[model samples]
Target: MKKIAFATCVHLGLSCIEEIYRIGGSLDLLITLKDEKAKDKSGRIYLDEIANEHDIPLLKIDNINDQEVLSSLKEYQIDWLFIIGWSQIAKKDVLEAPTLGCIGMHPTLLPIGRGRAAIPWAIIKGLKETGVTMFKLDEGVDTGDIIGQGVIKLDQNTTATELYKKVDDMHIALIAKYWHDIVSNNVILTKQSSADATEWPGRKPEDGEILSSMTMDETDKLVRAVTHPYPGAYYKEKERTIRIWSAKTDENDGEIKLSDGYLIPIDYEIEGNYGR
Candidate 1:
């Protein structure tokens, strides 16, 4: 049986673990980092339960760069290292520790939409298509040779939460289908074209703030992109922060004399904080 080391710190990582076990893949070691107890868009408790269920060797490391973690991984003789949703940029030594090298599962199509929150960013930008990429990890952030990629079309009404589910489904299927080839080092990797790729800086909580000058369409996109599983969008109203759960865009190009910074709340829920 092929031995694989799985490392991650989010719901996606947990899902990957469940999928791997369901497919009868060997999980020789599991590494996870401490994360906030906040629920994801799916309202699922992260990877904690899966780790306990599988009884996979777990490493609760504060940082991936820790020498103790590195030494433990070496002792396990990990054949393949699979990473998903790990926040820290891994060091070269840890990445190359596995005999087959490390593979990272990214939420966006390679060379484009690189960096954090790729799924939400793609939807907010009104992208027609986005997908997942499992690539060889390098020194750079998500800049690696692609081992496999799967694309999916985006619908006009697709919210970030919805798009995430589609990507998650694609990830599970791809990993099961390709794990053998990846572990054997027989997989064909395509080079990412730098010219065709574009990068987004990632969204900050402040980015979710609804600007008074923003158009209805822009506000709608913001609300949809961060609703539910995300913390939702926010705007200041009467010295209190208001959270927007849902919104609809009105394409009225005609002049309506509405005061600037005056917003019509279609649907909302108030939160104590201005931004998450």
Candidate 2:
């Protein structure tokens, strides 16, 4: 049996971890971020309970590339390291420590969408479809050889939370579908084409700000893109801000009017407190 280690600190990682165990797969170690280090991580959750329930050793660290982490990986003689829902990139030494190599799961199709804030970028770009990709990890960001991929169809109404659940489900299904092949060394690898590739830059909380000059459609897209499981898109007024959790352009009447049309805020939060 090949030894494996899993690292994650977010809901997606937790879902994948449970999927691994649910299918009778095994792990030598479970890795996660220190609680203090996880404050800013969206949908972050502790894995202590799951680890304890499965009797798997849990390792928490501030950085995945720290020397201590490298030592533990070597000590376990890990065959494969699955890094899911982790923000930090693994260094060369850490990537090479595992015999079969490190694996990463990205929310978008490899080569095409190969950078941060994939979920938001997918909606922001008005892509009708995106995908979940399982790939071998290398030095570059998500520029590794592909193991397998699952496509997700999107619509204008797709919100971040809805898309998040779809991606999470796809992750579980993909891992389960390939676990046997992976264990038997039957999983095929495909190189991503550089010509077809595009990258998305990372997003910050301030990036969610809604500008008054934006069209209603633009505001609606931004709101849906960042709503729930990410950050809420906001509109700032003098001395105050309003966080828009959900918005729709189909409504005839709305609180905020724009050049193209008006947007009805389905859910929102005022400066100091949330409002229904």
Candidate 3:
């Protein structure tokens, strides 16, 4: 059996963990964000539940650079590391710790969309097609060599929730297809083209702030791209911030139609301190 280390905190991470177990890979170590209570867009509990259920040793680390983290990883003698949906960008020592090196799953085709929130970035930027990438971990942010990839088409109505799930599904599929090569350390490597590379910074919850100056189409894309799991897009109204969970372009010449469909705050049951 092949021994692998897994790290993640998002729904995609959960899926990868589950698939790793299903495929009969030995997950010797499972690393994740410090918060196990964090929920995905679908409100699923963090990876702790899976870790406990699978009897995998779980490490909730805030910083992968800590000396203790590297020591713990060496103890496992792990064949490879999967850093999908993890919180921190791992440093050099962490990447080189594992015998076969660290691998990450980025939502966009690699050498492009190399920063945080690649899925949302693709949608907000009006990309027609985007894919998930599994690549070797390097010193830079998601600048790893390609191991495998899977593509998906994006339509105007493709919500962030939907795209996230799709990419994860493809991610798991590719892992299954390459399970043998991964465990045996026998696989072809493809170098990413730096000439075609473009990088974007990761987004914060406040980056979801929406403004009226944004085009109806732009606002629609922004709202849908950030909806669920991530902080919803919002604008200040009368000193209260109204975070939009959903929206669309209406038949009235692409006018922005708030999913709320009401002049007053409906609360939308989103996670916030505000009341209707």
Whose lDDT is greatest here?
A: 2
Candidate 2, residue 234: lDDT: 88
Q: Which portions of model 1 show Cα errors greater than 4 Å? A: 34-55, 251-264, 271-276
Q: Write the per-residue lDDT of candidate 1 for residues 103-216, one digit (tens) a residue.
A: 888878889887778877887888889899989888887788898889989866888778878988988878988877865667787888888777878677788888767776
| 28 Cα displacement, candidate 1 (Å) | 1.3
Sequence-dependent TM-score of model 3: 0.79
Of candidate 2, the 10-residue stretch with the lowest lDDT total is 250-259
Local accuracy by lDDT, each model: 0.76, 0.88, 0.76
lDDT of 3 by residue, 1-276 (tens): 557888776667777677767987667888876773444434333667777887889887767777867887889888688887656678889999887788887888888888878888988998999998888988987777899888899998888989978887898888887877888778677999999998978899998876656666777788888888678788665546667787554434322234432222222333445555
- TM-score order, best first, reads 2, 1, 3
Error of 3 at 4 (Å): 2.1
TM-score for every candidate vs. truth?
0.83, 0.90, 0.79
- Model 2, 98-128: lDDT tens digits are 8899999999988888988999989988999
Single out the weakest 10-residue window by summed lDDT for candidate 3.
260-269
Worst 10 residues of 1 by lDDT: 253-262
